[model samples]
Target: MKKQIMLAVSLALAGLSAPAFADGSGFIRVEAGRADVDIRADGIGNGSDDDTAFGVRGGYWFNPNIAVEGFYSRYYSASYNDGFDTYDVKLHGVGVGLVAKKNFGGNHTGFFVGGRAGVARGVATVEFDGSLEDAEASSAKPYFGVSAGYDFSETFGLSVNYDRLKSGGDGVDVTAETLTLGAELRF
Candidate 1:
């Protein structure tokens, strides 16, 4: 399933890399929103909830239609109890991606879609009736999403997008889906 999804995204990006007006924009962005997280484990009930999340992203557009971006996001902590022991989990991730976008309706308003392949780290701290146990897992993953925005001026704009992180290992599986609204400054 993961491979298929990655292949599909790659194909889509290759097909969409057509040249645009080519402006070479560079920017920094900060976003805040919510993340819905799901943690599944064997012999334990799933821990799934919504929590506050935020991210910072920076990118440099090589043209009006293409850019490379890097981002770091922090998600809210989730707690789980299954009649015996309780667990608390907090997840943070960083990644780099290629963003293919096009400017339309002038030079600053349009829609973009991109694919991301990166690594994520998961930290799980478990509590067993007065004792504490901690485990960490890291994995490389892939995700794809879309966004649309308009530049209020030549240097500022707002955008919203949905991003998902798929990660699993070391006795736990987690999927984080986040919707974020952000402000950006272009220079």
Candidate 2:
């Protein structure tokens, strides 16, 4: 299922690239930030809830005001150690979405605000510390985000983004809120 989702997104992004290249509006972005994670399970209590997070995004602008984007992000990883047993879990996602942008000065450069909504395949992996036992769960969920940024020029920019994401399975549930600083380059 994960493989299928990834392949579909890759093909879609590849198909969208041609028009972007012709119009000089394709973009790639890299971001790093902190994620605050929340975990709930049938038998386990909460542990640490913060971690370092990072992501990569690629997209093509359909026009000056809208774009289709694809992204992969590692939201969080956490571990809990009880007196006798230990549990570890990791969460990540891949998704495709649409973004609507409004530049404050009516130009590509300067202040911009945007909103994005999409469907993501979220995966959670859990492992027992002392035993070689592990399990995996995945589900499709809706994810969304908002962004505010400064575009230094048409080719380079910076932004701050906030995203809400979720994933879970069996008895384990995971949700995360991420704050990131990103740099974008247009080609």
Candidate 3:
């Protein structure tokens, strides 16, 4: 009974989405940015760290104004410096994101909003820089994100996004904000 209800709801949302963005153009984009992770507990290295990330993104249209997009994102190398210990982290993620947009007038520009769902993997390596004990942990977590974008031409656009990945592990919760520039093609 409950399972049937849940399936019905999923189908309804999916159906609602395609119609709102029934027509769309396809595109491919690449982005680069920085991220930080905040540790909310006492650990070997529990603080904010700076890291670099890059990714490839693409979208396909169902009609002239709606489409689906996915991104493969990876963090190069992230490390933190604490008085008691030094820590290292490696993070990788992939997601399928969908958005809908359309032009209100003959301005040749448009607006869009979409959601993304995906998985993330993290590898944390800790070393005692002072008197703290060393440790290591690996975790696989699920995440979701939302985004909005505008088209500058049939081939180019820009967008901003935010994501939350709450997989209960490693004594901390991790999340980040992402900004993107994109390009698209029309059939």
For candidate 2, write residues 33-77 as lDDT tens digits.
999988777687664478999999998777767888889999887
lDDT string for model 3 (1-187, tens) is 4355446545854776655554555677677766555554447554556566667767676654555666667643555676655666555555554555655424546775656654444444445555457655545555666667776665666666555543225575445444444344454
Error of 1 at 36 (Å): 0.8
> Per-prediction TM-score, please?
0.73, 0.83, 0.57
Residue-pair clashes per candidate, as listed?
1, 0, 9
Would you list the rank order by lDDT, best first?
A: 2, 1, 3
Clashing pairs in model 2? none
Q: Which ten residues in a row have the lowest lDDT in candidate 3?
A: 176-185
For residues 65-109, write the lDDT of model 1, one tens digit per residue: 667677888876667787877776678777667776555646555
- Estimate the TM-score for candidate 2: 0.83
Summing lDDT over every window of 10 consecutive residues in candidate 1, give the lowest-scoring window.
Answer: 112-121
The residue ranges of model 2 lying beyond 4 angstroms of the native Cα positions read 1-21, 43-48, 83-86
Is candidate 2 or 3 superior in lDDT?
2
Sorted by TM-score (best first), the order is: 2, 1, 3
Choose the strongest candidate by TM-score: 2
Find the number of clashing residue pairs for candidate 3: 9
